[model samples]
Target chain A: MTDDDLDLDLDLGPETPPVTPRARPTTREAPKSGVPSAKVMAERKPGVLSRVGSSVSGQLSHISRPNWSFRNFLIVLAVLVSLVVLAENWAAVRISFLGLRLELPKALAFLLNIILGGALTWFWLRRGVAAREE
Target chain B: MADPGGAWHRLLSLLQAISQRGLWATVPFALLVNSSITVLTLTIEPDGSAHRQISVVAAPYFRDQVPGWTRDVRADADWDMAWAVNREDDFVYNRDARIAALPESGEAAALTISDVAQNPFSLYTTYRWHEVVGYSYLYDSDPAAAEATNKSLIYEITMPGTVTNATVTPATGSSTKTEGPKVVFELAASQGQQTIEVEASRLRWGYLLVLAYLAAYVIYCSACTLRHWLRIQPRKI
Candidate 1:
């Protein structure tokens, strides 16, 4: 219970040094091939026109190689025939439709063609995805 | 899940499934519907002629001076009456009718009847009169040229039935004569107003059959597509 006993009880381990923060890396390591790092390239914004052009080109590339099938052929034939008939009897057909009459026959016909073609394309894509899964 | 873009994606996928299952059936339906509409809109025949009557007042010089005044009265039954007056005129004096822009004046005029359906035997009549300024040198020397040059009016009428008692006013030529389906009347030295009359018969039973068949086919194909689409199971996300 003397001073020596008190010092022995209080003693724990050897004094540890104060920890210092690690220094920030001064310069980024150069890319091995001399190309900009992915982080740096991604940080740069693309021009509006270039972005739009890339997206359009991507869609066109996707559409260029449609899977050929009987259903696709029939859909294409039906669309072509509808377009031809619309072209030949534009005046008569324009007047014939009740409430859906349009001023520009070619425009209306093209709109209809787009809707039909889009629907068919969607169907083809869905079927292809399903078949691949199976 | 409540986002608008998510909802749009779901709706699009649903449509995709429906269309994929029913595309085969829908193709024939589309073809039938388009063909039916084309046939109904363009080729359906009318019950009667458009019946356009046009009278051109003869100029003072042309009143009685033209010897063969009625020689150019051409009657074409096969010609489309709707486009009769719109056609190009063959004669120089009759060319005025062919111009659509110029106002109705001088030797030409036109009458149009809209919404009138086309017919197979619709009669188209054009009255053109040319002056007979004596006979040419070859015909001047021959007496037959004088007889031939004498003012003559010709009526060429076409109809299915036999043209019985067909006649023209101030008649001085041969009686009503039948040539196949046409009735021709030649009159000598005529002046003033003249009238020609004949009866026609038309066949009218095939159109209904065609329309009915088209309707039935469209309905059948549409029903099949609908049934197939309804039976399809919704795709799992």
Candidate 2:
């Protein structure tokens, strides 16, 4: 049908729905503690110490929080203590492994075990994040 | 499930405490247990009153005694009845043999045993004295300190006379060595038996015989010295 042939039924037929205004979220005030804006902050990589501290903290919070599972908490703690023990035994000695004997410092062993602790820490973090999601 | 006071539960609790408190949590226990190692040394006197010297490893048993000195040392002190009576001398610290330096430290202290009942405790009798020289403080005469300890104890007892016989109750892994008047009974930690019993007797005449022999040897040496001096002297002088 042509535009001129169509009847003008703006008021005669059913009422036309009004268009909803576009809503804009208001800007939040700057935090008093001087926290950087999430969008503005650079996505720089965390140092080794920072990553280790975060993992340890996450594992401990899992231990101390009221709803923490005992087995996981204990496993995490065991990982932490083993790491510390490895660090403390930073001395050179003859280490026999699978019939092959070699001399190495315990600190080297500690460096090798650090990754193991980090892995456990990551597991705890993933589990915690999953629980939170649930 | 393990009991709350059971070893497993206790270990879990300790781990929990360490997790809560960090590394500093262990420092107090180490300082209290490892630093003040208690060694009981008992030497029988001529009059038969056992002379006791309780020596303790220095405050820095694990660490350096001085700034640069790393030798493990136990400091000895004269016995004071007042100190023990006040309960200031009942510390239960003992050397952990696992610490490699302990065996080489050469810190052997003599602890006195007053538990032998004086009534039947005569040197003339050939009977055995089953002294409970472990942590049982029954013979310590301090009725208030009646707790049993689990630490390994080394008993270095000197008999006033010759040892007729010597034995340790837990003879397995336990060493009992007698050198004349002195008897050394070492109870290792792995033995797990807290009670270490020793059998000792005195030879009243042996002391006199030793003293007489020493005197005769001294006299003979003096006579030889005099003869040599006379022979070396100038005749005109």
Candidate 3:
């Protein structure tokens, strides 16, 4: 049945309900704000595209920031550069300088560079971590 | 109140993150260890064949028989000799072991000294002998009082035939011999053992180094493969 028809047939009491309106303070909670409030949701799962997008954006944010991660990136880059330098200057590295000349192979030269680079990396990283902790 | 499951998930994610970064440290270390092992392996293995055919001619030396009527002098000695060949001029030898010293008297034959030293400055020297086996012999006999004077001989080899390139049909046709220097030999039977000392240079060691490196690399690769397999096992399971 329609509400109006029900009301007309059963108008038994004049006292019903009272409604109030007032100007709220800043701290006071409003019933309907611009942002939707949390509700008992049915838990609609995120789609594949949404998940992928979120991950990609997170990675981008991490990469863009100049932080520890960036320093790590530079460290890797330096290592790569050193590797190239070792490869290109393989002959130079193999040859040792004294009063006379001594020649070794590219393998030995490459090994020396790796040892030096690894030791340096370890020392620098350890110190960096210690400083951060302090 | 919170879900216990959520905390487990976070911890697992953190562990994964740590492992991924940890791999960065381990990978390079593994590579270096593998490479070094490979170089060490190079030191242990033998290199491929180092063979060269070199023509050698040594200066003639005296061979003598003390008492003989018939004496023959011959400078044609067989030279089936071999020594080490080196790309680099570095000398590698067992110092404690006594090796017959090279000719120290007069200036060594240009070919012998140049070849031994691998002196680049002597690149233009015409003579290059790899092996030398040469000798000469003489016989002298005097008849007593009235007996006929017989058998006083000294022979020197001369005019060895030219080693010419000739074409010959295998079965159907006879091979033609072109005219060249006649092989001349005046024979005197003489018995004497003469030893001429020639320098055998230091053995080559580069090949050894290369071989060792190869063996080491192979071992390193095996280790790397093992490490990779071990690291992936947990993931697979």
Candidate 4:
């Protein structure tokens, strides 16, 4: 009941730990500028338009990479030239063949040229895949 | 890293494989086959008979629509005929009122023609004409029915050489008669089939030319393909 007894009682619990203040949860500081918080950025989902834009950019980057060789370029060029020649003299070339008859509109013919050109270019460029396999 | 020279060598090797394996020749072979079929289809008998069809339609288009309609029809018809014939010169379209005089030459004549008009539905009616030469020539509007009605179709064709015998099969609901040098027939507006079998002596050299050209092309492609294959073969040790 005395002051000494009270101090002893308060101090006697050496083995038992004293109640300490709980540590505050660590958090990233908010950006000084008007930028959004990391939580908001993490929580926000990518929109459809943004996703499409990123996908297209990725494809374009893959396609535009400098992986083509001189011979591949030459082959692609030759094929493209042939396609142009075919498109230009389509009627005459068609008539030369007795049974091969095809009549395509100008727009459709141009579209065909683009598709064939893209395909040939892709094939030639991707010959590296064959090299890797070998 | 890839061997820059190796890529070229591989390309050559691939091409060699294509030639040796006859992979690249598939397209040319297919073309040759198609050309052969076409040649057979267009062959003209010694009696100058061919498998051909002539159709006439009453184009229902105003002056403004006539050009577009005629162009579209002509393009379509030309594409269709190109499959069976070698030339488009045989098909003609008359834009004037004047009837073309028969050629003095003794050559076989087959022409599918269309007439031009300011207004097909107007009070003044315009006439369209077509000519075909074969043992049997079918005259119907079903082929061109989508373009216009053939209710008032009239055919005036002058067969080459002396006509031995001409007969119209299923002779019903159609008025057909022979004139001095031509046969005229009026077709019913409704959908139907009518065939005219004419026996006559005519000459056809276009078929021979087409066959020769196709044969030459096939031979050329085959020879080139074979030579390339042989040249690329590795020499024996």
Instruction: For each candidate, give its TM-score against the true structure.
Output: 0.22, 0.27, 0.17, 0.22
| Candidate 4 segments exceeding 4 Å error | A1-134, B1-61, B71-150, B201-237
Docking outcome class, model 1: incorrect
lDDT of each residue in A1-134, candidate 4, tens digit only: 89999989878866866889963343565688967465534345689999999999998887755534446655755665555444433221121257565544444566678999999999987998888888
Residue-wise C-alpha lDDT for candidate 2, range B1-237, written one tens digit per residue: 635554444355345433432111011121213433444565544332333444445343333322111112222222222121112433322321111111111113122323224433333423233343322111222222211233344557666546667776557556788887777776543342233334444443433443455566568668878999999998984
By lDDT, rank the candidates, best first. 2, 4, 1, 3
lDDT per residue, candidate 2, A1-134, as tens digits? 76654565533677768889953342554577997445433246678999899999998887744433446545655665565455434444445578665656556866767889999999999999999999
* TM-score of structure candidate 4: 0.22
Question: Candidate 4 overall Cα lDDT vs. reference?
Answer: 0.38
Best by TM-score: 2
- Candidate 1, number of clashes: 1
Candidate 3 Cα errors over 4 Å, as ranges: A1-134, B1-139, B142-204, B235-237
Worst 10 residues of 1 chain B by lDDT: B36-45
True contacts kept of each: 0.00, 0.00, 0.00, 0.00
Candidate 3, true inter-chain contacts retained? 0.00
lDDT of 3 by residue, A4-117 (tens): 988987886576678767433343343575663444333466799988999999988877554434456457556655554444333321132554444454546668778999
Q: After superposition, how far is residue B119 of candidate 2 from its true place, in Å?
A: 14
Interface root-mean-square deviation of model 4 in angstroms is: 14.9
lDDT per residue for candidate 3 within B1-237, as digits (tens), equals 766774565345334433442111011111111111101000000111111122111111101110010011111111122232222432111001111122223321112333223543332212211212111211122112101321111211111123132222121212223334211111111211111121222222333333454566568668878999998786643
